[model samples]
Target: MSEVTTPAMRARPKRYLYIAVLIGLLSFLAYGATYPSMQAEAAPGTQASLEVDVDLTEWELNPSQFDFQQGDTVLFNITNSGRFSHNLEVSNTAQHLNSPTIGAGETTTLEVTLDNSGTYTIICAIPGHSDLGMTGELTVSGDNPAPAEGEFLGIPAMRLSPRNNTAVVGSSQEVRVTLHDFTLNADSIEGANVGGEGHWALFLDDELIASLGEPSYTLEGLSAGPHVIRAELRNNDGSAVEPALSSEATIQVPAAAP
Candidate 1:
């Protein structure tokens, strides 16, 4: 003889099954709340491979300004169109990239990987070439945060003392300059092109007389006549500041006592 199974006994097993399922679900929810998901993080900025054409001529580089994102690989197709041998050099404090010298009517390629973001000096490596204006600028932007207030981002303003139409009573004169939104980084002179930090180039009668890392300089051996003095902001690599921030003053130096 077999014993009959009660309805309550059967319902007890169903309740136990439901309770086990509920407990498992609650445990899963708790674990999810405590730990973060194991998903892959996104990359910062997107990198790009680019090709650019550059024309080299006497004391000039066509397309003098360049813009690019950081971590870019740029292949420069350089052609010498002038009647001289020229080579290209791109440099900053962090890296230096150069190309072989190519003669007129010749062509070459330079591959550069811009890892850092800032300003880089682009110039012809030949002697006296950059002085004659065979220079350009390469600007690399990154995903870095923006600069705070009091940080320079554009061209600076300059003013020279001894305002125009002033007279001095000697063969030497002291000129003082005032600058705004700029810093003179004497340590990095001729090193690399950094943003917002550089020295000043002093020009007397349209000729470069000195590169000043300070604000005041004295002029000696001056002729007894009117002279024009100009102060121009320059980059660390000796390149002219963009938009050309400069101040000019004309003064008369009287003859010395005889």
Candidate 2:
């Protein structure tokens, strides 16, 4: 028993010290990586409504334009102190459009985010919208804000031109859109087979006019009025379904210019 040497007495103390040090290091890194973004994430969704006056003729906006890091959360407030039957739209330069009715005198807040690290365009879709200074953009970079998910829903991106928000009906208008690529595994998006592609259907708020399942598609012979176009997708199972990534485009198809 003399060889026992009581080595356990020395080893136990050192092991306990090492464990304590390791835990401290991990805790520090965890906090450091998440703190900044958690602070930047503006309250859950878009901002709340605002009170505006009806007598004013001009308006002001909090952020005419914005740029954010991947994990950053942006907060936006809309102020419309102008006299007109108008609203504000937000989008990226890549053609994401939004149109909110401010109704001569109203104010509100909205939000958009980039879960992907890329450049984007935001615009107001009211007729003659962007041209009337109703548009702005938000550029994002680095690791984006993804939806706590690890899957793709087979949905592709949709876009129109800067001047596409307003068009003249019964006129030869250029209808263009682009669909990007996405990857899906484990079939979490429904009827998803595997190695299937994505496509889009253009509508005039009533009828289906074109099917753009490729990179880009255009619709001709369009009549004028207020029109809203949507791009939906089909899964690997060849089912007409709404992908998690559907986008809507609005244009004022003015009563065929007389």
Candidate 3:
């Protein structure tokens, strides 16, 4: 037997369907509100952008040399691992860029576009820093580029003991150096470049005799007569300090008895 059509029964089924649709719509809206849209990632074996890691330390930059392709965008991740403050500067004839000073144990980022092919100088803008070997080079493949000019720093105050015209009875003489705004690091000598820290170069009669790590040095094998002793501050790599800080002392030695 065929069932008779009833509008109320059919209408009830439609109402249930409507309620299900409404619940589904509400659930969709709630999920959308709770979560953010996902972003597309780069395909495998591909990168969205080129990145380079740079390390800054006592008077040096890790990966001191690197290269990039022309017209490519690069992101430099710079980290300061040294105790002193440092900054990075990238300059070429086509572009010049600088990063803010990064204190010890800090990190920063620099983004740049290499539209032109050439060599870029990377250095620490802090005075006397680059001179101490806090520098690097970036080569953008293509054409030759002009070399960047170097920066200079002022000299520190220095004083030498063993006053001029002082008489010495023995062949050995004691020399002392008093430096201001600088430190003597004998352990770091010939190790790595470090700012505001290095050893002193001792000169006798304008000749290099010794590299002194301590403040005082005893000179031996001195002949009887007027002799000149000089001391100059130098970097850990034995490079001459900027502005050439030095002090001299003249002393007289008596002749040996016959």
Candidate 4:
């Protein structure tokens, strides 16, 4: 009688082990409730006290123009204070070169969050000076994010290679900015719209530099003559709603080498 166990072979292996443990517990509780973690003593850079005085041999643009309003999480305490060598970048689209680098009295901070309204830019990709302008612009959202004829979210047109467009102010310039066509409805990329995509800014001439997620760069201790760089394609609440393809370039820094 010790051989009487048959309910269809124990309910078919307990119904295939309860459907493989309920599909691995709903894929580990949906990846632990959607990605979240950032605390290694927090503050990676971005606290804002306002002090952007980047002068790559007098290109001139102190307080050029920056407004920030949608939802502002502000903080751009970059300090290259001048003496050559510089970096800074922030982006939403124009293909990904999201900027960030500071050297020459070095100090960094750029925890931006803007929330979107429309109008975005920030330059310095290095190559021939962002096409000869070194760029700037960021406005975000608000261009009728919908309520009548829907469809809003665009800033994907990044395609640069040939050594990240070009830049040779002092030396070492291999910069890269690659990302493209990031269509969106908005949820993060500038909040509201509940989908995605937006952010761009890289300037080293006027010195904002890069926030690049991937565009490529190596720029090192600059100090030569004549410089300019640019990149702007934003919309993640920092704005620059595409200035008819906003961009700039102009390079000539090669000097320091005695």
Give me the candidate number with maximum TM-score. Answer: 2
Off by over 4 Å in 3: 1-155
lDDT of 2 by residue, 29-76 (tens): 999999999998768645333332222133333345566665444444
Question: Can you rank all candidates by TM-score, best first?
Answer: 2, 1, 3, 4
TM-score of 4: 0.28
Please give the clash total of every predicted structure, in order: 0, 12, 0, 92
Overall local distance difference test of candidate 4: 0.51
User: Candidate 4 residues 1-258, lDDT tens each?
Assistant: 578887898899889999999999999988776645423244654433333343332232244457665555656655555554445455543223433443457665656665455555565544344444556665543432211112233433554432222336346555454545443222345554222355556776778875443445566766666556666656666566544334555555666667
State in Å the error of residue 243, model 1.
1.0
- CA lDDT, every prediction? 0.81, 0.52, 0.79, 0.51
Give the distance in Å from residue 24's predicted Cα in candidate 3 to where it truly belongs.
99
How much does candidate 2 score in TM-score? 0.44
RMSD of 2: 13.9
Spell out the clash pairs found in candidate 3. none
Kindly list the per-residue Cα lDDT of model 1 for residues 1-258, writing each as its tens digit: 998899998899999999999999999999887666444333556566799999999989997899998889999999999998787888764455677677789999999988777788898866568899999999988864324435565647665655554566568878777666788887888978887789999888999998888988988899988999888889999988887888887777887778
Q: Mind giving the per-residue lDDT tens digits that candidate 3 earns over 27-140?
A: 999888766543354455442469998999998989899888766688889999999877777866445566666788999988887766778888876656789999998888
TM-score of each: 0.41, 0.44, 0.40, 0.28
Which residue ranges in model 4 land beyond 4 Å of their true spot?
1-70, 80-84, 91-103, 106-111, 116-177, 182-224, 227-243, 256-258
Candidates 1 and 2 compared: the better one by lDDT is 1
TM-score for predicted model 1 compared with the true structure:
0.41
**Model 2 alpha-carbon drift over 4 Å, by segment:** 1-73, 79-108, 113-155, 159-172, 182-196, 214-224, 235-238, 241-245, 256-258
Provide the lDDT at 194 for model 3. Answer: 79
